[model samples]
Target: MAGVTAAVSARLKADEARRPGFYAAGSGPLPQVRGSTLPVMELALQITLIVTSVLVVLLVLLHVQRRILLTMTGLASALRNSG
Candidate 1:
């Protein structure tokens, strides 16, 4: 109902007002690092993630059929052993 929505909105507003940091516009508190270390660390993490994702995609593409066959064989072996 509209009344419930209004109450929820009011509660959220009060909560936000009570915690300014919680609704901060910028990235939450920066780590205690010297000079540009923080940005460098963040960039490193981003690059690592991108490279990892690309490698994973390439690996999957290169072994799609082999992976599928191995998965099915493993599943069948598991089922057979379970009986």
Candidate 2:
């Protein structure tokens, strides 16, 4: 079983190396750092987080506005009926 597993692993590694930009470095099975790719990945992650945060804030504000409008509407109706 071990021998078969090793054979398959080796074949997979060979296939991965054949692809473009497959950098295998360090003492691990994966690349530790491939040129300037890490920074690009970080930037992408940051941008995604910022976009998500802004959307959440906007949605919360909209909900608050809707609740305020509903409360005002109820108060106005009560005042009219009282008079």
Candidate 3:
């Protein structure tokens, strides 16, 4: 087993020696990295996705229910027709 390994290595060494340049020749394409690719990290990830989507819509309008936020801002039909 050892002998086989030695033979393989020897062959590889011989092959390398025969080669004039780029013996291992970057076996593939991977050499393009010039980055600070920034518009301030794309404006800081669009201002952290607009401040976490306006802090998750102000924490879901501070957890809903003021009569479902005055029936979604129609001011619950003018405060239920002014009592």
- RMSD in Å for model 1: 12.6
Per-residue error (Å), model 2, residue 45: 0.5
Greater TM-score among 1 and 3 belongs to 1
**TM-score of the candidate numbered 1?**
0.38
Q: Which segments of model 3 are wrong by more than 4 Å?
A: 22-83
Work out the TM-score per prediction: 0.38, 0.57, 0.27
Worst 10 residues of 2 by lDDT: 23-32
Task: Give per-residue lDDT, candidate 1, residue 79.
Answer: 100
lDDT of 1 by residue, 19-45 (tens): 733552344664454565668889999
Model 2 Cα lDDT, one tens digit per residue, 1-83: 99999898787778767886674343256645557677898999999999999999999999999999999999999999999
- Window of ten residues with lowest summed lDDT in model 3: 22-31
lDDT of 1: 0.79
Name the regions of candidate 2 deviating beyond 4 angstroms: 1-35
| Candidate 3 positional error at 59, Å | 30
Q: What is candidate 2's CA lDDT for residue 30?
A: 60
Model 3, residue 15: C-alpha shift (Å): 0.3
Please list the C-alpha lDDT of all candidates, in the order they appear: 0.79, 0.84, 0.74
